[model samples]
Target: MTVARRLIPCLDVKNGRVVKGVRFVELRDAGDPVACAAAYDRDGADEITFLDIGATHEARDILLDVVARTADQVFVPLTVGGGIRARSDVDAILRAGADKVSINSAAVKTPELVNEVADAYGRQALVVAIDARRVNPLDPAAGWRVYTHGGRVDTGLDAIAWADEMARRGAGEILLTSMDRDGTGEGYDLALVRAVVERVAVPVIASGGVGTLAHLEEGVRPIARGGGGADAALAATIFHDGHFSLSEAKAYLRARGVPVRATEEGR
Candidate 1:
């Protein structure tokens, strides 16, 4: 049986509140992370990604209380990221009720953490997040670079190469976010998604810049069909702004020939 493409809604939490921004700046409040997560779970989200956009920059720990609260209210897989620097941090988040842990800055800083987490929690529980930006906005061929600290720092590493390394190091999945398209609402950088998708054998989650329901479809369709070929599509703005319900988004994809898991209401 073919695997169903997943639709994940991201909650970029800061100071315990969900926020959205353009290219990771000028963030505006959306709602309480726990409340927003519960709403998505009710509406048919396959999984929810809770990213603490400020924890790494501020050098703080993830809010375990928020993770515990959200997990208690949702049944879908909960992937919590940011401020995860060590295996101990991963242990804390998992114990707090998160199903998976995503590591960004810390993973790039100490690549071994990827291996360590995988060994301790099993590869299925580790997700490596890659925040990538094109070296030249006008030139996709220039390739992409990796960014960390909530897309605030350029690591000067080739994004595709980094993704392969992370996967080889034991990342079960990769959360690939296009920093340039982040919050722009244009759409995902399909080239960037395709590049990373082609490079790594693990599942790639296409994130950033999802304006229309069509964009979500484009992110998950197969590359042979002129799509990004991502195993999953993630978005924040379109969902938070009420552009469409998660059910609507899934329905749209199904209508367009993408196989997605049906919601509880069977829409």
Candidate 2:
């Protein structure tokens, strides 16, 4: 069975407004989430991700109304995360029209949170997000470390090991972001992505650092031959900054031999 590669455009929203930043700082307004999501849906995005980057740090709940408004404007599946602390929070987010709920800080704080949510909502509805940064550029053995609270605090956990654990705990997917490569447009941390993909059974969505459409190709396909590939490629600035429309990305991947679903004329 073949799974068509997914290209998901992410909206790193803060305070109910779409925002963009490099390495999760220096945020600038992009637009309203509802409008942005509607455009992406029309452009043929496979799924939409709205992350409330400020919700966790500010210790507030996710903007459910913002999610509901965005979901109202789009027909595609929506995944939401940030400041999701308990089962009640997950329940509320799903009720707000999110198809899936991504948990990072809360999951890190309580590893069993993955199991808890999976038991209640099924694993398919739970996405465990790993915000990772390379602790040392030189040591591949030390490996990348996981961070929480919007990539601010390092949890001292090995990212690879944590990913394996999350999958074991019944997480349906892993949303892996490379903080070092984020906003730098240096391309995704393919090494880190490959490592996690190799360790986990469920699909892994590669996030951060896409400078070109080719980077998306490299992520959803192999680096060379027989190399690791992410199940999905996610980006914020690329889609939001007038870089490439979702249709163009699918066409680029199709032309490059990556197996992406064809965009219908009306989508």
Candidate 3:
């Protein structure tokens, strides 16, 4: 049986306010994270991801109180990332009600952390977040280097190789975000999405470059059913700008012959 495609709405929180910007610059407030999440939940969002963009470098905690509050009111699954370093941090977030914990810079800095968390919390509860920017075409060796510290520093690691390794280490899923396409509203980097999807056995949540319904359509095209395409697509700026609702996006995908979540059918 073919599983339906997933639609994820990302909340980039900083100082308790939902913020978003292009290439991680010029941040703008979106709204209250809890309120935005609740709206998405009511609209039939498959899952919601909260990224604490400043927590890591600032040495902050994963705002378990906010996460717990959001989880309490929202019915859908919630994935929390940012500032998750140790197993205790993971425990706090999960205990606060997050369905999964996402680790990026910390996981890259200490590869064993992925295994450690997966061993304790089970693979399904661990998500590896990869922030990648297209390397300068001139520097062929810079292909897909991972970014850290809120995309300020480059780790010099090949994304595909790292993704493969994380999967081998028992990562349940990969959240791949393209810095180049983020907040551009142009479209997702299909090449980047395809590369990561082809290399990892786990599910790939494509982030960045979602401006229109077409971009959403393109994001899930690679996972099409019956050799056709996948169902849902994720967006931040598009949805944040109030261009479309989650239900509307699902209806559009379904009309395009994609298999979206069945519950989203008449809404």
Better of 2 and 3 by TM-score: 2
lDDT of 3 by residue, 166-235 (tens): 9999899888877888878878766777777877778888887888887888888754331213233567
Best by lDDT: 1
**Model 1 / residue 263 / CA error / Å:** 1.4
User: lDDT per residue, candidate 2, 34-119, as tens digits?
Assistant: 77777778788899998876645342343788788777878888999877888888998899889999999889888888999999
Q: What residue pairs clash in candidate 3, if any at all?
A: 224-229, 224-230
Query: What digit string (tens of lDDT, one per residue) describes model 1 on residues 73-147?
Result: 899999999778788889988999999999999998899999998998898999999999999999999999999
lDDT of 3 at 92: 86
What TM-score does prediction 2 earn? 0.90
Show the colliding residue pairs in model 1: none
Provide the global lDDT of candidate 3 against the true structure: 0.78
Q: What is the C-alpha local distance difference test score of candidate 1?
A: 0.88
Ranked by lDDT, the better of candidates 1 and 3 is 1
Score residue 254 of candidate 2 by CA lDDT.
Answer: 87
Ranking by TM-score: 1, 2, 3
